[model samples]
Target: MIRIRKAETADAESLALIGEQTFRETFGAFNTKKDMDEYCTKNFGTRIQQNEIADKNKCTLFCESDNRIAGYVQINLNAAFGAVADTSQAEIQRFYIVKNLHGKGAAQALMNAALDTVRRLNIKHVWLGVWEKNLRAIAFYKKFGFEQIGEHVFLLGSDPQRDIILHKTF
Candidate 1:
């Protein structure tokens, strides 16, 4: 069974590993392998994930199975989703499931946990951004009732791509 829980500092390294593996598996098709490697190594390093875990405003959720982290989601209540009442709004900055566990409902489980937390806090809305070329992720977001709110240029590797912002109203 997959268990979802708030991430603690102890989970940082595992979360980082999951981030790197998931990022590579998810975006490898849209970017060169070298670019993916550099981006993941720089952005999802243990220190970064650890810092996020240490931040009180930042909420990180981990999906564990057999005591090992399989995937995770990171959210920022103050930054991404716009300011509002307690739990009324939150920005889902990052959501990822390990590549090998993609179809096993890990992502959905993690998302449900995040949204449940939002609802518990009386949040009325949630939002996230997805690369335009990541059709799979876009569809996944849509499945959770997120709609495209807008588009913007995203610098990935040496090239620029469009990112579609999506949001859901609870």
Candidate 2:
């Protein structure tokens, strides 16, 4: 059985580890090793995880199976993206499942929790950005009724790549 719960302050290190592992496994092949290293270090560092755990309004939900964290989702209200304000929407900043648990429904469970939280918050919609090359993730989001809204270019240091901005009405 999998249990989904809000992440606690003590989960920062575990979250960082999962973030690093997931990023390296998923994006390592697409970008140069150096670029991937920099991206992971900056995004999944201890400090970032600490900050995330400290935010009460921005929820970080974890999926635990067999007493181990199998996946997590980070959601926020009043999201800011490149100067655009989405007051009535919640944004999924991150969602990841450990490689071993990919097809076992853990990801979907986590997503459902985040979506439910968004609805409870009375947000009209939920938005997220996925790398264009992450076909599996794009398909998963599509299955959840998220439609592509626009193209985004995320610059990781000097490397820039396109991402698809997807949204679903609550």
Candidate 3:
């Protein structure tokens, strides 16, 4: 059975570990080792995870299967990319699942819980920035009704990459 729950500050270490692992698994091949290492070190520390988990404006959800984390989603209610003009919008900041569990139902379950939270908060729209080269992730977001609205620059170390901004209006 799979269970989804809000992530707490106490889960900081686990979140950091999974965050780094899943990020590398997803994007490592497309990036240089130096860039990947720099990005991971800057973004996926336990202290960063703890601070994010404790932010009242953000919601972090974890999926557990057999008592171990299988996936996670992070949503930010306080901000959105400039494309989404509505102040009533939320951003799907980060979403990831274990690579081995990709074909399983974990991603769907995590998305369902995230959308449920959006509905509960009465958010008018939801948006996210996906790497332009990440076709798999873009397709997954499209399946969830997110449409490309614009583009933005995403920095991975010193690399400036394009990210497709997508939004779904409720």
lDDT of each: 0.81, 0.85, 0.92
Assess candidate 2 and give its lDDT: 0.85
- What candidate 3 gets wrong by more than 4 Å, as runs, is none
Query: Between prediction 1 and prediction 2, which has the larger TM-score?
Result: 2
lDDT for predicted candidate 1 compared with the true structure: 0.81
**Model 2: per-residue lDDT, tens digit, 51-93?**
9889875889999999998888989776845423556877898
Q: Model 1 misses residue 60 by how many Å? A: 0.5
TM-score of each: 0.88, 0.92, 0.97
Give the least accurate 10-residue stretch of model 1, judged by summed lDDT: 79-88
Q: Write candidate 1's Cα lDDT for 1-170 as tens digits.
A: 89999988988888888888877777788788777777787778889988989997789998887778888888887654333333456788888887778788888899999999877877677877788878889999899898987776766666688888888888
Q: Write the per-residue lDDT of candidate 3 for residues 1-170, one digit (tens) a residue.
A: 78999999999999999999999999999999999999999989999999999999999999988899988999998886776668898999999999988868889899989999998999999999999988988999899899999999999988999999999988
RMSD of each: 2.6, 1.9, 0.9
Q: Top model by lDDT, which number? A: 3
